[model samples]
Target: MENILNYIEINELISTSGQPSVEQFKQIADNDFEVVINLALHNASNAIENEDKIVTDLNMAYFHIPVDFENPKASDVKLFLNTLQALGSNKVWVHCALNYRVSAFMYIYHKYVLKTPFDDIDISLFEQWSPDVTWQEIIKISYDEIKNA
Candidate 1:
């Protein structure tokens, strides 16, 4: 497991992170990841230019959802899950600057979509730090909607 900044492999199916350099993409490729899902905006400080090309060049799919850190929406959560479902069993690496956005969304996915036991995923989700008030609310709202749907 090459060092991807803030990298955490949740399972064989998923990983989360901050931006990794092109060289690090090789490590992801080496690990047999088939998709790179970036939640960071294109203009995000560490966002790499031509990322789609870079990831695809490495023979991996690239899906950019561009989550707004200050204003995460429930729709973004839906889209993230949809993409993962569409990927079937393809290995995925989901990342955002510092892994904040990635972590929040992953928490929802793990708990709601995967039906994972709370205790199984909480420490991994919050190990670095818990989501702030706004993000926590976003997660709650998203989960509530899904539960009620």
Candidate 2:
């Protein structure tokens, strides 16, 4: 747990991190995480081969929503929000290659679904790395869609 790459504990219900090794996934399972949601592509840097099987074998539900780093979409954010809502209070561990995607998605989720004010939401993780134009646009679009709804 201590060595999980870029691991950020976002309250009791969720944790976000970079791609985790198989052993880290074991640690996540041992720590009582009920679900593993992967946003990284299968071929992403540091990604575990057969990660779905690895997580499922550890008795944790696994979800993969591959997000294109260069062109994040509002649909992706929507799906992430829907999945998180459906999962309810499950202890979910969400990760992407370097946590960039997860942070952005989590930011949108908090701002919209949780009805948290943007300034009140913690974006430290999202701010760890600067998002380029594509990511910025999607973040704006995602929030706008939710706000307009």
The best candidate in terms of TM-score: 2
Q: Against the unseen true structure, what C-alpha lDDT does each candidate score?
A: 0.85, 0.86
Model 1 stretches with alpha carbons more than 4 Å out: 122-127, 142-149
- Candidate 2 differs from the real structure by a C-alpha RMSD in angstroms, to one decimal, of 2.1
Clashing pairs in model 2, backbone N/Cα/C closer than 3 A = none
lDDT of 2 by residue, 68-108 (tens): 89877777887888899999999999999988899888887
* Each prediction's number of clashing residue pairs: 0, 0
* Residue 64 in candidate 2, Cα distance off native in Å: 0.5
Which ranges of candidate 2 are over 4 A from the true structure? Answer: 142-149
**Model 2 alpha-carbon miss at residue 58, Å:** 0.2
